[model samples]
Target: MIYRADPARYDAMQYRHSGKSGLKLPVISLGLWQNFGGTRDYPSAMEILGHAFDAGVTHFDLANNYGPPPGSAEELFGQVLARDFRPYRDELIVSTKAGYYMWPGPYGEFGSRKYLTASLDQSLKRMGLDYVDIFYSHRYDPNTPLEETMSALAQAVRSGKALYVGISSYPEQETREAHRILAEMGIGTTIHQPSYSILNRWIEDDKTIDACGELGIGVIAFSPLAQGVLSGKYNQGMAEGTRGADPRGSLRASHIEPRVLAAVDKLGAIARSRGQSMVQLALSWVLRRKEMTSALVGVRTLEQLKDNLGVLNNLELTADEIAAIDEASRDGLMELHPRPSGWLR
Candidate 1:
């Protein structure tokens, strides 16, 4: 059967302007970093993507090296687009990045124009896209000249391969420089994708969030649930299929120490008091910042995706609730958690 999107999709979700740009993003954007890869169950991915679009998620985030084998996520997403989303292409905001490791050789990765340009071409081909809505640098390549990276992003826009350019996980100072260089190139920085949640507040402490607010670069927080820690799944103990049990997963048992569990327990209590689940509270807390344009969530199942979308129904976080989360995260939460190593392919 041919898939037709709901006519009332726009009415299902609220949209926010990305930074100061005219483009707007659904408050709950979907990230294809995990289950959309080629190695994963294709039918499951199709279900989630279909439901997400039906529920009004317009933005779908991807990267060149997202899958376990790398690049497969784009390959899979391309298939989905051709099959079910071709008619809705104009309404969707599809983005991909290239700074991380892709191919083997030295020039295969990082911020070089050669790598970025070639990677985007490959991505466009894999995703069957004429041009991506946004292309990101993926990370700060300290080894490469900042000018070189920014110029490559400019080249992407100049070549009409990307409508906008952005940077991810860049420090405040570096973010300022990149934004300046992009403006000089006549292409304004669109948004920044960072790892932010109650457990990980480095963006706030490092002033990246503050800098983005001042510079007018929108922030879409990835890992807003802290890699499932804030989901309350491990409050009692790690389950068989949970991230804590998966050897290759980002979350480890050590990450859920007793102190963290206690914090989660307190948070769960607060969530119940508000008639919301732990995941909903975590997402609402992240979106509380006026500077936050959207929250990028990765869902493994259709139920999880729907739960994430339901957060938009009640985004209000009371002052006391916010303070409670702050107090709970204050102790032992200062440890630097591992962000996706942008260098790793």
Candidate 2:
């Protein structure tokens, strides 16, 4: 069977401008950071991709090292692209990143010209793409000169491997410098990807959002559900087959402290009061900032994707409602990272 996208797909989701750029990302973008790898069934991943597109998710975010065995996600996405998205390619905004430990040897990772350049080539090959809409450096590299990193990103565009360039998990100051460097090279930073959710407000606490807005760089939030803490699936406890059960997963069982669980329950009550599910409320809360271009979510099932898409219907957040949510989630907040750790690694 073939996948034909819904004709009315664009009518349901809200698309927002990516800062000063002409690009408009869906309010909620799908991320293939978890699952969708070689270990996961390809048919299920393809079905989720088709359902997401039908529901108006135009952006599919990926990275070079997003699999249990790194690089498998891109390979899986490539297969799906050839099968289902070949005809609708023009309507999608696909992105991939580099910067983490992708392969053996020093040249396999980070912001070095050798690594990023070679990485993008491999990524393009893996995704079967001539060019990714946006290619991100993935993280800041203190060891590599900012010039080298920014220039590699510039080369990606100049060489036509990536249309735009971005950085993820870069500190506010580093982001500002990267923006400056890229601007000097005649390629302004297109967007800044950060981890932001009700339970994880590092971007807010560190004023990264304010910094990006000031610099005219779009901000797309990842982990908006705080690694499933905001999904309400753990309100009762860590259900079997949850990310918490997977030791290799980003979400740890220890991350769900009693206080955080209490906050989650409170937030769930708030969601019910607003006539939405905890997932919808969590996503909508992240999009409350006008500066936020999109909220990136990882869904293992078609049902979760549909539930997240419901946030598009109600992006409104009253000041009082926001205040209430802030209070409810205050205790749920994770402390700021001393340095870019997990994802940045």
**Model 2: lDDT of residue 88:** 92
Clashing pairs in 1: none
Models 1 onward score TM values of 0.96, 0.97
What value of lDDT does candidate 2 attain over all alpha carbons? 0.88
87 Cα displacement, candidate 2 (Å): 0.8
lDDT of 1 by residue, 264-325 (tens): 88888888988898999999999999899999999888999988988877899889989988
Question: What is the Cα-based lDDT of residue 117 in candidate 1?
Answer: 89
**lDDT of candidate 2 over 227-314, digit per residue (tens):** 8889888777767778887776777654698888989999998999999999999998999898999999998888888899888778
**Candidate 2, residue 4: CA error in Å?**
1.1
